[model samples]
Target: MNVDPAVPLACEPANQNAGTALQDPEQGALSADEYALFASVARVRRVYAGETLFHRGDLGTTMYVIAKGAIELDFGEDLIAKSLGPCEFFGELGLLIGDHARSADARAIDDGELLELRHEEFQRLVEIDPTLVSYFLRRAIMRVVFNEQSLIRRLRRRNQDLQSALDSLRATTQQLSRTEALVRRDELTGLYNRRGLLQHLRERHRNGATSGLGLLLIDCDQFKRINDEHGHLIGDRVLQGVANILRSVAGTNDIACRLGGDEFCLLVKAETREEVMRYAEFVIHTSHGLLQMPQLPPLICPMSIGACLVCAEGEWNDWYARADTALYRAKRQGGNRVEWQDNAPIPA
Candidate 1:
């Protein structure tokens, strides 16, 4: 391990004998002939702790064998990468493969000694001592293989964990979707509830793009009288019947909501005012015609429809109030008739 003090420490390779005589083994432990051969081919250098020996993109003209202390190897931008202890070597693969630069950064971890061998000199030694070359090459190859296997195992475990987390997220999303649907829908009539209707109206108002905002507020004529005469069960059936008619007549873009008791609201996106009037008339006519009650004598279900066209300038609440006023007017005039807020019907 004895090294010559006369050898200048420089980053570049120096021309010297492939082997030379040395007194001590601190530079590297080698027999007389081995020392001569290596001395002719390589030079020894002392490195300080926390010093960068080589960077990731440095020229691959030389390789190092750690005589003492430890070195750290870094890949990419990682701060704490991998470490190599004393007697370990690195950068030989880059030299052997004719790589232009080092693949990873190497730094000394502690005050250390290293044997730096020039690429040409090392290749010459490998050619001369084939057996020694084969021994070191086999060990290096095994080390690389073991490292790759360890990396593969870690990646597989990470992938499994990620997949499990994704599955859990998917299950939670499905459960939330079901809960939201239940909240929006009325249980008794199977229509959208008042809360859902308000939410829809607010969203439409926010958009402010008037395709056609129409609201119809419908109430069962004399609903209290029917409930008093037949009981609550018959009243429930009447509500279900009205809901069915609304569902059948309303378009996909339209929403039918039961605003509790016998009051219902229909929000429609009609192309024209005429289309809105036609839809209102259809709902009023159909709801009055379809009355199925076997328990009561002469089952007749009538509804008062109050329809209004919502202006783009008005709020959702303002539009709802207008529709409510029209509904009251229809109820005052007659039971089974439709009334519009803007257009009053002529006396026949």
Candidate 2:
């Protein structure tokens, strides 16, 4: 990045209209000889608004001191650059580097006047007054170094603050993820809980209630006998095994949940009654397989499943109750069969 030079002293309005006789540097703090040299060499020039004083890559053999108004700097298409008011000077970097061209384009933003100094005249002044040259050069170097150090410190602090913010964001995201999983899952079987399944049903209802909204309520046939024969621990394992079977057979958009005890439910968005039946058959056929236990004989766990298709006008409880009644009828007719509430005969 190129840094502009500090504004020149001759640019000050107080110094602008000073009579030629008093234009001598000695008129202020300068010695008589120094004032004579300053006055003799400096030339005043006027620039109008919208005028281009210089452009990037132009030779910078001379510098200007703004006497009045402002100069604007343009980097490119954008006016992101700044303006220099009266008493501000630019273009000294070219002189210091002995470069023939400028690094940026300079334009007059308003009608302005400048005191121009040729490279030769500036060099002559420096030669005659080493003390003045040394003082100005030291001040310039100190200002540049101090500004650089301050910028570095600010950047470092900002980077540290940004890193800390990112860490906090990451931690918060992890915690939310774990919480969401817990909210949607059944603690015992790791299947979806009743609340989660109901939430999914509501979402489906909002999406135009497409066909094949099949709901099934499954009840273990003679669950009380199983609990009496084996322990609740074994019964719990059986329930979990049932949940796993339902999860495997269900589609990605389907939901399987353990309502409570040995009762479970499934929700699927099927396009037709046949599609619903196909899934029901899979569940029935898969549940026939017995679960093995160390202390108990192979348990042939069977489920009586009843299914119903959801209609757009019906309430959520209406579909559930109809399916649940079908489930009871299936159990009454000797378990382990798929029944539909539409009076379609249970699959043989």
Candidate 3:
């Protein structure tokens, strides 16, 4: 949030060598009328060293013209101070403005003198000498415009920097979201892991919008027999086949997960017992095809599938128990078949 100090407008003071060119009575370039107006309408004041002519934030409508010796304008906030000697002018901006506050402090560096004109007296001089009023008015307005334009440029640069910071923050947030998704995914199967599945179910329950939710619990029949005969490497291949089968049968909205060791489950939407049975049959049939694949030669046993019609309002553990009970029954009925807890499959 640090910003470089701004360069002031060209109309502001610059280094200048003071001289006594206007010391003589007739040397100043004022007409007889202007001289009379200047003397009558202006007041003269003198200050000793370190004397304050005006303080910032003080209200006034007078502008001072430096007459003799040396004085300086100091802006404490900007840490700027500029010296003015004889015949140089400052604070003309106040004369053209109404009820103006000094933007900086004015103090004497040495014994100095200044000529000040109140706004009302200046207005009367303008009436008497309209051309002279026009001369100073144009210069005063140009100084104000230049200062304001410089401020605008600084503000625009600051706004651009803020926009760039916001864009970087948005990019960082997107990267974090992608990283979180990778953490939830199962590396081998590309399905949700058990932890991921539980998190998903909790979110769904908290939302209270889960309707027609269904659960399918599956087990590979005679899986231990295959591992005993062909070794564990071949057993891992059979588990991978089960993952593929679940992927094939899953609907777009369904969440399929491997719950470790020959057990898999699919969560889906199915309002009726018939719809749940159809999904269970699809999964069982797909898993049976894995036996034909060359890598699953030892995995010749069929899969057992059990399904439950989920009640969205009930606890998920109770619903899962129903599916487990159905899976136990299907396995007891001797492997490759579908069963349900609330409703049984029609005899074929």
Task: Output candidate 2 Cα RMSD.
Answer: 27.3
Q: Compared to the true structure, candidate 3 yields what TM-score?
A: 0.49
Show where candidate 3 strays beyond 4 Å.
Answer: 1-171, 292-301, 343-348
Q: How accurate is candidate 1 locally (lDDT)?
A: 0.66
User: Is 2 or 3 the stronger prediction by lDDT?
Assistant: 3
- Candidate achieving higher TM-score, 1 or 3: 1
Return the top candidate by TM-score.
1
Tens-place lDDT per residue, model 2, 151-242, is 34555644553344335445544554565566667988899887677766767668865455788888888777878888787788778878
What TM-score, computed on C-alpha atoms, does each candidate reach?
0.51, 0.51, 0.49
What are the lDDT scores of the predictions, listed in order?
A: 0.66, 0.65, 0.66
lDDT of 3: 0.66
Per-residue lDDT tens digits for candidate 1, residues 1-348, read 234554322322111321231121112223333434454556678889999988876767676766566788896643347676544467764544444456578888998787787777777765666434443444444444344345446556445533443354455445545655666788889899986787676677678664476888888898888888888878888788889888887888889999898999888887566877888888876764555334353244788888888777767677777777778888889767887876333223
